[model samples]
Target: MTSDSAALPGERADFLQTLDTHRGFLRYTVRDLTDEQAARRTTVSELCLGGLIKHVSGVEARWMRFAVGGAPAMEAAEPGGAVAWEERFRMTEGETLAGLLEAYERVAAETDALVVSLPDLDRVQALPVAPWFEPGATWSVRRVLLHVIAETAQHAGHADIIRESLDGAKTMG
Candidate 1:
């Protein structure tokens, strides 16, 4: 377990460990890659190693805001529409793999600290209005953490595939 998670209670520590493990996998997948290589599209999907990091960072940050202040905090945090959403999947001009990784680490640190300090994991907040979500749905802090973990793990898998396609490197055998 990481030092940050070591002092946390059982459930929270578990969340931190699990999240860290997947974050490590995603970071490892981009090991030693150049910025250009990290930004290269290896499949029909717009995803790239750096872009996955960027997207996941944004997602986790947004969800943490939701955890702290519900849906409104999340909506107010990022001021963007469809175009900005699309940009999250690709490295824009002046973006670098190192810079993206650093930003991701910062987000991860903030999330870890928040998770540890939150008064209750059971605190529930109503979800935002979206067709993908059921109307009147609410999620606990635990649920948000779970969603963040799922998102990280899913993107880590995507990064693994992209990394493998880019070179012969694999996150695991």
Candidate 2:
């Protein structure tokens, strides 16, 4: 659950630490949980714990790709697609919490390696057309990493709430 980005100093370490803190929150929320438990929608939100993790993992992977390459095509498998959006909220058939967790760990490891090895944090990429994004925009890799961290943190909070509603477990307590 550790990130190599923490080994460095300055903004890199700070960013990694922030990301790790939230990742830890999410990891703890899902620990000791079974497939059924993770799949449970404890709150009114359609997002289950496993689904949240999957969504985050996929998003990080895509952004990492964008950082390394350019943005994907409009019809690509990016999350904005109708199918991807629906699948992002829950475990699809044959997907388990453990399996998704393992995949997420792999994605996290790759993302950390990229973050640490990239020579230029300022490398920028133009964002793809999306309703949620501006008509034309670009973001640096560093900004993308920060966005990942922020997203993970937000979902961690949601997971905490869902965990509490499920079995009265509180990650913050």
Candidate 3:
């Protein structure tokens, strides 16, 4: 993102740029695919290209929610239905690769702007209730941003493999 395009300060721009790089790579994996192609599972892993995008989108949105609101507040914002482990890794009914990517981009941009505007990246928040997270582990907002970046980047790599297996497409050379 350019300075003229986004108002992020120097400190925040680095974070945004790193995130944008991986985000673009992930999006590239499913480009020009039909819904069926995107939902295909080429590896033994259940993860599909469309589902990876949706997973990252939901993850970032939740973390951003926690940053803007306290843990308790963020808990209240959760969707009524819980996402099952396997379901989280595949595109569900009525979902398409293109549609998920579009929504992911919107959420990703919002997350970037929100992170840039934070007065202090060191600000901390309690983690939401989850069996996987340590009982008392809390994360700083900056840590949350870093975590999102790591999560997205890992998933991007997974998406690249899935794409390649499906049709020999590569997100990057």
Candidate 4:
């Protein structure tokens, strides 16, 4: 286990800290992006910085609600849910970098608020319909939070590589 996985003062604090770390990674991936650069696909893959931002935000919103046993916010229902890996990375018409960034910020704020209001990370909740996971499996709040962190961190790395290829930018902090 890593230092970040070590026990902390409490579950909520630890979960939030992990989330914040991943969020920082995501933010860094899109740092210094211009509107055109963010939406540009530099690789054979369809991924652009803007599309990645939108994807992560959408995941955050869905998972947060799933973890808390709450109905997902209406905006979370957009994009028809669970696009294929290829489709997810693609930038659609009318999907501007600025628009995606704004949506990300909005969804992130809602997620933060929901997590903050929870009393404990051990609360029982249902898992979202992930392709690899069993249907209707339950998870503790802590597990869901950790999953979100892991998911975001992985995608942030992808975004970093794409961003670098787009303009020769370094991924180092």
lDDT of 4: 0.72
Q: Each model's C-alpha lDDT?
A: 0.91, 0.83, 0.82, 0.72
- Per-residue lDDT tens digits of candidate 1, residues 1-173? 34666788799999999999999999999999999999999999889888999999999999999999999998874643333777888898998999989988989999988998899999999999999999999999999999999999999999999999999899999
lDDT of 3 at 106: 79
- For each candidate in turn, the TM-score is 0.95, 0.90, 0.88, 0.77
Q: What are the C-alpha RMSDs, in order, of all predicted structures?
A: 2.0, 2.8, 2.2, 5.3
How good is model 1 by TM-score? Answer: 0.95
In the range 9-68, model 3's lDDT, one tens digit per residue, is 575777788888889898888888899998988999888899999899888887788887
**Which pairs of residues have clashing backbones in candidate 2?**
none
Query: Which pairs of residues collide in model 4?
Result: none
**Number of the top candidate by TM-score?**
1
lDDT of 3: 0.82
Clashes in model 3: which pairs? Answer: none
Rank by TM-score (best first): 1, 2, 3, 4
Model 4 weakest 10-residue run by lDDT: 1-10
